[model samples]
Target chain A: MQEKELIPYLYRTEFRKITAVLCRLFGIEHITIAEDIVGDTFLLAAETWGLKGIPANPAAWLYVVAKNKARDFLKRNTIFNEKVSPEVQYSAGESHEIEVDLSPTNINDSQLQMMFAICYPGIPPESQIGLSLRILCSFSIDEIADAFLTNKETINKRLYRAKEKLKQDKVKIEMPSGSEISDRIETVLTTLYLLFNEGYYSASRNTVLTKDLCLEAMRLTHMLTENKNTDKPEVNALLALMCFHASRFEARIDKNGELILYEDQDISLWNKELIKQGECYLNRAAKGDLISRYHLEAAIAYWHTAERDSPEKWEKVLSLYNRLLMVEYSPIAALNRTYALAKVYGNKAAIIEAEKLGLDHSHLYHILLGELYATVDTQKAIRHFTAASKLTKTSADRNVIRKKIDKLKK
Target chain B: MKEFVMVYRSELMGEIKLTAEGNMVVSKEWENWMGGIAAQNKLVSPGMRLGNEGRVIKPGNVVTNGPYAEIKEIIGGLSIFKADSIEEATEWAKTCPILNAGGNVEIRDIIQVNG
Candidate 1:
């Protein structure tokens, strides 16, 4: 990369690494400081690199600069400065050199610890998502606001309050041990799941930014699958679910950035490697009889990615959705179950079930109704499509509904 | 300990217009600096970062742009610090990160006034 291009590129990859290590060094309460030092390192690089040109080894240069800033912060402000308050002694052995270890092992450990800390159950789910985006994903305040469709002040306030709550409660930045791991990991996994959905299904207009959010969520989930404390059937299941969904990321959107319905999508655009990875993780997740929602969802998604069109694929999908609803009840999941029902059974049987849902407000509900009614009652289908077109928020959804109306008119 | 306000002002000399990416990283540094003081338990009030552009409402009902006739240096922010004396406060002010960014901090003792 050229000198001007390198800063943003490094910011994307190294921001989380440096911040995690600094949080590990300074303690999670001082995360604002950790983030600050990381930002300063990048800012200084931008300023200096502009004047002096880029360093030969920019990433290493950043690490060294960040370490020095961390040390500088400690020496001037914290307990290390015995001169400021003579009676108080430095307890953490400020006598020894402050080690800002950025080694791969330390970095990974720190990031893992930091991830669990951000997902602490004490924090609200909204705050958890915000913290994950800022720290784990290294999204700037503005970028975060854009993704969530909020302003900078709200994001800043949410992050500040979350960190303060962590400090007040004195939550440790470490992995849970023994049985506690099960509960804690569940929270972490749930947070990651919400984060992925936020990225995948967010109403934000910026498709690229939303995709980044999903990919970042996947990265964090993958981290859990590797750690011993969190290495569970459910974690792998969640990873598999994410992988299966991500595999269709390209196929889901057309060249014009419009959403593509499942049957119409170009299967060739689907990522083969990601689908393979999903299969591997799904197999690993099969060993346990846990039967988490993620395992069921992942199985359903895997079926959707089958190479050839077959009724058997829809049958598998239908059964999994049935199991998933029994495992946990969600209206959206119930709605999805109806779609799979349409695929396995005749539209008449599916239409009978879909009407029971009575999800009048959802544009998706009307769209599904419109589809089911197409063969039985064309007039009803046109009316439902008109209703859906009015309710749909995005032009893409409206576009599909409009086409359906036009087809019925013809 | 005495209470003093450190007013940060900067001409922001040779301020190169930062790219959007560069702009993203700047706010955190300010937060880090303020949080440092608060962590020390010396921060009386975590002061507000002032706006660069403002309109001064004059004695009349008329409004005008610019806080001053000829504005150059900007008052970046203000925060109260607890230290033993003006000298100590000034010493702490010397370490303010704003100074590194072409800014200076003016330390002044807060006088007790009867309401």
Candidate 2:
């Protein structure tokens, strides 16, 4: 397989977890040095494994290479040159029998800690994710900029300023306690959710599917599960939510790279294993009495994945949305739920509910309302489709809306 | 082993906007400027940014309102270069973004006190 095709299989989430752990153990300062070693290690794996057949333990092989490389770097830079103070104990002659546990840092145990350390509630939430992506995920400054759809210079300034604040506040890599963890969890979850959406949205054209983003969120959620002190009911709910949504990754896009709406998607193409995993996570979440927005969203996705996955179950989906609305009211989510209601109940009800949504800023809500109007009230629908067509910036989307207008007129 | 500093300021206002094609151009320019110097291990650091509006503190307890001199003629970013002479530093700065916009290059010498 080409490197692009093999990337999803080779450097999976497990490798990222291992990398995170290794980075934490060896110190964040050694991140670049360690990453260089890891990069070379992957290159060697591509050459060796591609020819000699896959190794029994690929991650272990990569881990060993990373550790050895780290040791070599420390020897050359710190021990031999004495660049760092000699007090730093990087002794060369350690016992060969002893094994080093170069596991990646578990965000599960330390996500709250990492969050509080990075997110002081003073800096904007966008900047918090900017720092997290850098410090936690080890993304390059340019990579974060691409993710944010902004220039590298803007991202660089945000990261520099964020790091300065972290230094000024003297934030440590440890878990937060009590109410602080709860508050910080919001930022951490929001960042992860946004990260997942960016991946799901798959903004970059060449990379139609960024499994890395999904894997990153799953790895972070796994960290939450592992950390005894940091694990919360909401974390479990989020994990379930991610798993349920991720189950449909294969069916989300067509072979031609066109967007496949959920109603038209091939249900059989959904990953049953991921659905099973999501179920397990949902069960784990049920242990706690506290219900979260993740739980509600996951429940709705579970319903869609459960049976026929037809438009028939729109009522059930609407009920789940109502439940979600009770927990946290989002205009976007409400718009989605209203669409479901329109399908099950009728167009008039959907239009009435959607009109009250106050989503004047969103082009999508207008489009959805227009589509509904086309069926029940053609004149009103034409007006809406025209308004929506005018409101959108993307010519591609507007072209679709124009087609819809033509169909409605005919 | 004297280090020379080459400060590159964008001559055009909002002209440094990098499109996909522009990025390809700028990245190539960046590589030629930095990598050419880095081959000799003399490129200390390369930094670039447009102008920002902030208070400029001057001597005699004076504060200037804005990016100082001219908005169009503001300094974007600079590189603290480690080269043999001002000629080499000027040569390096010659390949800067300004050449594309018909702008000039400024090269400064670093004075050592201890040596």
Candidate 3:
């Protein structure tokens, strides 16, 4: 089949799932080799599929090829005796030999286990992220470095150290049981969220990496939602939150990659498909009695996306922020909530509320205050803008604030 | 696990490269490098940074200031990494930006009591 036609069927999602299963079946010591075998299967497919036209079942063909490769590799290693014979592995569409569950139930659990192993507490965070991207997302060390705005050498060192740590700790490939699984799930979700943020707020030339992180998060969440054991309300809520926020990606920035405040962005550019998915996930997330931060955040983002002209939506956003603040006292969330309050109420009331908080140390908070004061108090706005310009490190941000300050003088 | 302190030293004290807009580029780069390291969770707890008043203490007395050794030899800041062996620890030290600034990473095994 044409490469374009096969693109949809052949994805990192399948690659990660198959590789994780093989790695679990074999051992952690052979993870690199297992990944190599998986890569070779894809390479073979790329060459032969175009000539033969993709088989009616491409995943099965790739799986057969990969399984054979794994057996051959294990045969060479001597540590693991090859289990499956190449001939018996592929027997029509149905086979009892491959007991592995590629369904959401099985795949989600395996992927979550793999994610936790990569982000293991003992491993350095840099290595955690780099190894996760390389092992699970198929990102090269150079690509990971570029995503984090660092050199490839740094990424290489981190990956090596992370792998060594896992080896030394004798970390198993299987998922932890009971309460440990819950803790591991939290870490795994957090790692994925951080990965998304890196891509979203990345100071890179192309903002596409951010969207890639969002898609990866969604894919992982789907894996969780599919699994019977792992399909908790929080997992679905997290997916809903990501979908709602990601739906606005197109309107978040222009072709030049400059920041567009949420208010100034074009609502028409939102993705309807993603919005619909977000609503479905949100409904599923609400099935449980307990509310999660993700549930609240998704509800807030839905409110914004669902109604473009509703000025009262800003109040709902603030309320959601307040609820989120109760769950987690993050300074960033507080700063954001204060800004929304400034928009809803007058600047004086908002400024008084903001002054009571310790957010005066944040450059972003000062900028928001400056923006609130631009019309009423020019000199105070100028002072705050100057303070923010001095506090901010990004030249792009400084330029915008300086322009604003210059305009206020007129 | 072996702990290695990769000290990032600098020669210029307050000499910053200021842009036409009065932005300090060197300090910005320094902050970016530090932020990158911090992002990776390499920063150890109870970390202390020495400023202009830092002094070298000897067995008998404390030296204030004088024609100290080369300015590049002055320890600025340190990043800690845990590795299985000294060699593995040294490998991590090689990536520190201090080496690019004409400074060397001093590798010493951290002494600990087993009790």
Best by lDDT: 1
Using TM-score as the yardstick, the better of models 2 and 3 is: 3
TM-score of chain A of each: 0.94, 0.75, 0.83
Clash totals for all candidate models: 0, 7, 4
> Cα deviation in Å at residue A262, candidate 1?
0.8
Tens-digit lDDT track of model 3 for A306-388:
66546688767766666565555566766767776666676786776566455667788788889888877999999999999
Regions of model 1 farther than 4 Å from truth: A79-96, A307-309, B1-115
How far out, in Å, is residue A213 in model 3? 1.4
Cα lDDT tens digits for candidate 2, B10-111: 544553455443331244345433533443345566545545555678889988876646455666567667776777677667667666866666788778
- Interface RMSD (Cα, Å) for model 3: 16.3
Question: What DockQ do the predictions score, one after another?
Answer: 0.01, 0.01, 0.01
DockQ of 2: 0.01
Where does model 3 sit among the CAPRI classes?
Answer: incorrect
